[model samples]
Target: MLSQKAKYALRALMMLAEAAPEELVLVQEIAERQNVPKKFLELILLELKRHGFVFSQRGRGGGYCLARPADTITFGQVIRAMDGPLAPLPCASVTGYRRCADCADERTCTIRKVMRRVRDAMADILDKTTLADVRGGRVDEDLLATVA
Candidate 1:
């Protein structure tokens, strides 16, 4: 399940992706445009900045902008930044894998096997889909085929 914070972060990033190159967007403007709470957005933006997704400028004409090109930024990266591992369970996580406490044998665990497949499928799509693809509505045929 996607958290409210993650949703807001994606919305904010999409807005940044749509901006002119090197354009610095004010937090207030993003909050208003995206219908996100200003205070909450400030915290979210700060976290994103810490994660290297965005860069913030201080003082007059100060604002935030993408730290890298939108096409270079994957949805998986942003989601992981905002929500940690993409796997449904710790044991299924590729980046933050851990054995399930109840599982006696991971290799033979049916639940873990299914979950690992789920995680891989999700990662396949999310990692390949970038902010540019989403913003431009350019759905990859291969992705659609994979999903189907």
Candidate 2:
């Protein structure tokens, strides 16, 4: 399941991607615009900044912005940076591999095979979808609502 925290992060990043390239937006502004709780959004942004996805400028006209161009930032990167692993099951994850202890033979497990396919599908979609896609308003909310 996608946590509310992860949702907020994606929504926030989407808004930031839409922001003017040279214009930094304040955290409070993002919260208000996105309907996100201010304090929680603060922590989320801090985590994003820590991950090199965003940077903050302190001052009256300061807030946060993407550290690099949106086109270079993948949805998978943001999700992984904030949500840990993209896999539904540990055994399904390529980046954060963890086999279930109960599984006797992961090599021959039917469930493992299905999960591998699921993970591959997820990786393909997210890796190809960049923040630029979000900023350009190319998001198919229908696709996002699939796992919802």
Candidate 3:
């Protein structure tokens, strides 16, 4: 499950993605449009800006916009930036792997095996699905085939 922060971040990014090119969307506008709290969205946008997902301008007519094209930013990147690794278990993680403390032999651990497959599948889908896919308002045919 995505954390509330991650969900908000995605919502905010989606709004920005749909904006006109180079248009700066006000933070208050994003908060109200997405139904996210203004204060909480400030923190989330700050974090996203730090990650190079967004850039902001100041003064009159100032606000935030995507640092790169929406098609280049994957859902996995945003989620991972907000929530760390997508893996359910540390032992199953690829980027943030940690051995189970109680497991004497990870090589034969059935739980790890199942979780690794789960983690891989999740990564595959999220990493392939970009904000462009979402903004297009239709499922990718290839992705739909894979899901089906």
Q: Give the alpha carbon lDDT tens digit for every residue of 26-85 in model 2.
A: 988999989999999999999998889888999887889888888898888888888877
* Cα-based lDDT at residue 121, candidate 2: 84
Residue pairs clashing, model 2:
none
Which ranges of candidate 1 are over 4 A from the true structure? 136-142
> Where in model 2 is the C-alpha error above 4 Å?
140-148
Query: Candidate 3: global Cα-lDDT?
Result: 0.94
- Cα-lDDT of candidate 1: 0.91
Winner of 1 and 2 under lDDT:
1
- My TM-score estimates for the predictions, one after another, are 0.93, 0.90, 0.95
Question: What does candidate 3's lDDT look like per residue over 1-148, in tens digits?
Answer: 7999999999999999999878999999999989999999999999999999999999999999999999999999999999999999999999999999999899999999999999999999999999889883666889988788
Task: Evaluate model 2: give its TM-score.
Answer: 0.90
For each of the candidates, give the backbone clash count.
0, 0, 0
Preferred candidate (lDDT higher): 1 or 3: 3
Off by over 4 Å in 3: none
